[model samples]
Target chain A: MKHTLSVLVQNKPGVLARTAGLFSRRGYNIESLTVGVTENENVSRMTIVVTGDDTVVEQVTKQLNKLIEVIKVSDLTKESYVDRELVLIKVTADGSNRGEIMQLVDVFRARIVDVAAKSLIVEVTGDEEKIVALIAMLKQFGIKEIVRTGTLALGRGPKVIQSGKD
Target chain B: MNLTGAKALIKSLEYEHVDTIFGIPGGVVIPIYDELYQQDAITHYLVRHEQAAAHAADGYARATGKVGVCMATSGPGATNLVTGIATAYMDSVPMIAITGQVTTDLIGNDAFQEANITGITQPVTKHNYLLHDASEIPQTIKEAFHIASTGRPGPVLIDIPKDVQTMTAPFDYPKKVHLPGYQPTYEGHPGQIKRAAKAISEAHRPVIYVGGGVKISGASEEVRALAETILAPVTMTLMGMGTMPADHPLSLGMLGMHGTRYANYAVTESDLIIAIGARFDDRVTGKIASFAPNAKIIHIDIDPAEIGKNVRVDIPIVGDVKRVLQKLMPMLKQTRTKEWMEKVHTWKREYPLEFEVTGLRPQYVVREISRLCPDAVVCTEVGQHQMWAAQYFSHRHPRNFISSGGLGTMGYGFPASIGAKIGRPDETVFDLAGDGSFTMNCQELATAVAYDVQVKVAIFNNGYLGMVRQWQELFYDRRYSQTKLSEINFVKLADAFGAHGIRVDSASEVAPAIKEALAVPKPVIIDFRIEPEECVWPMVPAGAALNEIIDAKSGKV
Candidate 1:
């Protein structure tokens, strides 16, 4: 089964590499990982989607807690949380396809943020599944370019997660 | 006290009383090395290769019972130490490896010689880190050292980028580390200790199956004392070779595959087996169900995972061996079992390790070498000869013999002996190796010569990868395949490094050749060309019990 782990780490040069390195070294397949600074200036939250057995995930959590830079890790799949991903899809937008694409974007609650003479840029913000669905639809218009912020997560309420809090 | 992270790191090491640091300097690691320079605490040994530095550090740690330290730069330098770190990890050597990383900004840009070292080393190390704040450096170093040296000791890496290392920070070195997940139990429970004593007093045929725990727990003396007081025969796993003096009445040589005839008999016949500090590796215990079938086993280890990893424990003591032994020593009763002693003695006489030496037997040469240099530290690489030395050599003290037992690493002997010699300068050290095993790390002969370390190397040259050849002869229908190795004159190879060398083709030449080398004031090599098809006998084939050893002397299984 696939699970998304959102890790809050001290913002440092090697922290992300260390995270990626841990996954690869332990033979944990990281399908996708996105990291960026949090509202807190000193901390960076990274969302990583990985597939493994329950035991392996537990081992991974314990191992991650052992690293000094990692401040916290939460298996967001277990929590009442929100995971979001943003993707900018640039598709050819000649007069023929622009109107039809804009109608589909409205139906999906996404917006066409940029438009040039030959292409249109669609900005979509949703969970990974929603983003993936929009990306697949835009591919029909002959997508010229695409970039995705993999996944970002936040826990519900006032609850805070700490690494090795146990 | 105000101190740099580097200074705090050195001070923490000083608290641990680390005597030496092995590493190569680089820009990223210079700040730490500078702090190392400021202290008169631990002397640093500049090794040519980072990998060698790591291995040397491991060797020093394994030999001296102290935490070994090594440092290197980020990227390739840190990557080079991977094999050495893995070697230590696999063998359970305590080590702290520090690496310098690219500065804060350049870290992820794939800048000049910069790579994520903590990430790279994460899986290989028992624990690892990437330092973000300079203030956390001192505590991280302490935590790394704590994790590395405590419980079942293993390697840990701390990667500090150049920016973090140089950044001035208030370093408060904590005396005690408080990691709930990492607290290692170092003493057995009182109830378990009492049960162990009860089993010992009640056992009709008791035997102590000792392993590396005796050394790692620093319990060799305690184990010896307990064995003597209880009057139980002791058999050691290969890793436990030097835990008890070989000449002691309680010592039953080594007890496993290719173990001595008597030692295997004792283990098989014993009703109660007390195993300490030895994990039940497949090589040591064949067919787990049938091993020590009639015996009740009491296993003690620091790591809880290892308790039931192999065999079901009848009484498990999860703690450090030394501390457990100390706790149990008071509970042990004064007793003697003359019947158990005599029964084992009968097995010894009936089935002694004997081979006719009409010509040059490697067994005879090992015995001769031991007799000539009884006090010299004898180290062996894993194989038939390693087993041969274990069977033949009369070790007079604990911690005097060293070899790669847990991992069964081939290239460990030469470097391990060099490290051992450096620690114990008063004693001459010899690394007894097969030609194949010798060549695995023969490059280290230069290390010996360069360090002005005269570690005597004795190679049993059989013109093949001797161990595999023995198996092929016995089991593979004599299909040699690639087991026949290259014919390299190792003596000439030793000479090319500006060292002394000798070759012994005859049995009579063995003693005189060693005498000549021992007389010389420099390191020397002696290659003994023995019978090629000779196999280490009293062999328990894979998937056989200790009692089922193949006795080649009788030409029968």
Candidate 2:
């Protein structure tokens, strides 16, 4: 099964590597991960997608929490949460096919973020499935380049995952 | 008054009650050494090799339950401590390893005598720090010691740059550390304890499988109480040997690859396995899928990471072993397991460990050591000698037996014995070592004699790397390539180093030599000429089922 975990860790050099090192050393499977600064400058939040059984996920959560840099870890798999991934894809759109690609982008509710003499750069932000689907549709037109930010997540409503000190 | 970072570091160590430091001085660490020379609060023991310093500190901690401290200079010095650091990490020994680094400006420039010690030790340490400023020295040192001694207890590293060490800072060690991420759970959950207690009371064929955690948490008494009340026989892992009295009727000597036949049988047949302070290592489990096949496991460990790391735990209680057992003991109902006890007794009687009596048996040497130094803190180097000591030495207290359990590092015993002697001067300390391992750190004999550490080192001189030779004889068709060792005149070496030395070639001389070595006022080395081809028996080849053991003595099982 797939589990999403939101981990809060102290802002410091090598903290990300150490947190990720635990997962790799213990052989825990990580599907996708995204880390960025949080509301506080001294803290950073990491949203990791892990695929394992109940026991494996539990061990990962506990092990992550054991790291000295990590302040808090929560498995958001069973909770209501919004997850998003942003992808910038450049596809061949010279002349005749430009209108057709723009039409497809409009249908998918994505926007053209950049334009080149030979191609158009489409920006899409949504859940993994929507981003994946948009990428698949754009692949019909020759894809020149693609970059994706791995999934980031937040819980719904007033529930906030805070550090122990906070 | 403002003090240099090096002085502040020393002050913080004093604040943490660290009186002894095992370290070697070098270029980057000269500033700290200069400051140390000016202070009388902490005594320093100079080691020939940085590795031995770490091992000695580990021995001190294991023997006395205090956080051991070791220091080394940059580059080669810091790298040399890796094996010992990993050794302490594997066994969960509480240790603080401080290394002096190149100046901050030259950190990544590949400057002379520079090394990224923290980066190198990342996986082995519980936590590590590289100071960015001089003022952070006191708090970092406090945090390092706290992390090293608290919770599951493992080695922590602090790498201080030379520039930072020379910078001036106000010395004020923090009274308490505030690490929001590192709080350890000490008390077991009430519902889980109740469940565990109920399960123990109801278990018919129950076995308490003990591990090093029992000793680490000082929970031997609590374990004994719970075991006796529930009438469960105890089988301990190699690291768990001294956690309970070895002579106790319920105690099943060391269990694992070289574990006894009956202990393996009992575990296989048991209905409930109460695992305490032990992660199921591959050596202990043989084949994980088949280990304790009929048993439902109740694992009690302080580290949540270890609860299901290797084995599937049916009931997991995450807490300090001592605290968890103390709470669970009262909730448990006393019960008798007469039928199970009878079966276990029969197995024990039928399959006692035996060896041919013709030549000088290593087991006899170990037994003599135990008899002579009954209260001694025993340390061992890795290999066949370690196994024999684990099997034969009768340990009466929790801290009595110390060895390189987790990492199984060679050449650990001698220096560790020195550390143990320093930690507990009132008690005798012995290093049961093999010729191969003794040669690794025998240079430390000078350190011992100079300081009068008075640790007895008994070498099992088989003229070969006995354990590797055994593997070759059994599995590789007796091709002893590089197994035979070049000879050394230990007695002459000891004399040159100003220590007592005795060599015995026969079984009759074993006891007398040990007696003589024990009476010596200074450090002593007794070299015993053991049978070259002797192998540890009841061997379960790696990955084999526990029951499929090779009993070469009788040529029968």
Candidate 3:
């Protein structure tokens, strides 16, 4: 099972290493992780996607909470949450298939951010499933390169996982 | 007042009421050592090895319930402290390890005597800091102490660059720390406590399993009270030794891999396991699935992650053991467990801990030491001597028996005993060591002698790594492979260090040598040449279930 966790931590040196090192050291499976500054400049929010059962995920959340720099951990897997991952796929598109690629991009509501003589870079932002589906579709067009922003997640409602002091 | 980071560091330690430190001076730490020289409040014991310094600090922490402090310079000095730090972290000992790093500019350049200590120690330390500025000293030191000594206490490291230490800053130690992420839940949930209490009252064959957490939390009395209230037998894990009086009627010696047969049987047959301050370690739970097969477990620990890490916890109470026990004690109703008690008693009587009385056995040496110095603080180096000490010595108070439970580091006992003695000068301190384990840090005899820290070390000189040898004999077709240790005349070694020394080859000479060693006012090492092939009995083979324990007669009980 996949569980997405929202972790708020102090935006200090080695906090990321400390958090990431924990998962590696404990042999916990990390599917994806994205970190960015939160509403407060001093705090950073990390959306970590981990693969584990309920018990293992619970242990992961508890262990993450144990880190001194970590402010809070909210498992958003069960909650109604919105998650997105931005991906860029540079496809080998020449005059022959450029129109077809643009048509496919339009149907998927993606943008052709960069165009070169032999390639077109399509940028798309959506949930993981949508991006994965778009990538699979672009693979047939001979994808030159693909990059993903992992996953960024938030609760669907106004429920916040921030430092209580804030 | 304006002061350099080094001075401020010393000042912050004084504010924390740190009376002693175990450390070794090095290139990067010279500035810190210079400041230490100007200090009168903290007495620093210059240890021979950086590792010993950390272990000694850990020993002091275990004995005094105060945060133990140690220091080392960067690179090799800092790397040496890794094992000691991991040892403390594993056992949940409160410790603060200060390391002097290369200057900030050279941190990533691999300058002279440089190491990224914070990065190296991240996996081992509970928390660590790499300070680049002088002004962060006071707050960092305060937070280091606070984090190290708080809930689920463990080792915390603060790495100060040499230039940072030389930089000047205003010194103002923070009165209180503001760590929003580090608040430990000291009180159990009311609903969970009620559920646990109800389960305890309903259990007819309940066994109270205790571990190092009880000692760390200072909950020995609470554990005993709970055991008495519930009329449950108390079985201690290796680290839980000294948390409950061994002679108490409810006490079932140490449990787990090398645990007593009765303790294993009791846990196996238990209807309810009231585990306080204990993690279900693999050593404690032979085969996890089969461990306490008949029981519903109530795991009470300060660390929530430990609740169901291994065992399936029926009732999980995340709180300090002392506070949780206090809340749950009143809600408990005593159950009638006469039949269960009789069965446990029968197992105890049938599978008593015994060894052949023919030769000078290591167990006999430990027993004599325990008999003579019943009130002494006992520490042990890893291997056969450690298990024998755990089995033979009777501990009656928290921190009385300090050994590396989780990491099982060799060479832990001697320096640790010195630290233990320094912490509690009134009590006798003994290090039950094996020849293989003792020589790892025997250089600390100089530190012990110089400081007049009178700690007795009983070296079970078996001329082989007895524990590994025993394992080979039983499981590996008796191929000894590298287990044979080269002999060293420990008496001569002790004499060279200006400490007293004695060698006893016979069981009859053990008692007299201990008495003579006790009379000496300095460090003493009594090397006892024992049966080379002796093994710690009541063994549960690796990966074997608790019920399949092999007894003294080599029969499955």
Leading candidate by DockQ = 3
Question: Could you tell me the fnat of model 2?
Answer: 0.74
Summarize candidate 2's per-residue lDDT along B129-159 as a digit string, tens digits. 9997889998888888889998999999999
Q: lDDT per model, in order?
A: 0.81, 0.90, 0.92
1 or 2, greater by lDDT: 2
Cα error, candidate 2, residue B342 (Å)? 1.0
Scored by TM-score, the top model is 3
Highest lDDT model number: 3
Instruction: Write one digit per residue (lDDT tens) for candidate 1, span B124-221.
Output: 78878777768887678778888888778889998888887666778666787756445577878889989988988888888898887777778888
Query: Could you give the TM-score of chain B for each candidate, in order?
Result: 0.92, 0.98, 0.99
TM accuracy, model 2 = 0.98
Q: What TM-score would candidate 1 get against the native? A: 0.77
TM-score to true structure, per model:
0.77, 0.98, 0.99
- Model 2 interface DockQ: 0.70
Candidate 3 Cα errors over 4 Å, as ranges: B555-557
lDDT of 3 by residue, B284-346 (tens): 999988999889999999999998999899999999999999988888877888899888889
Residue pairs in clash, model 1: none
The residue pairs that clash in candidate 2, if any, are none
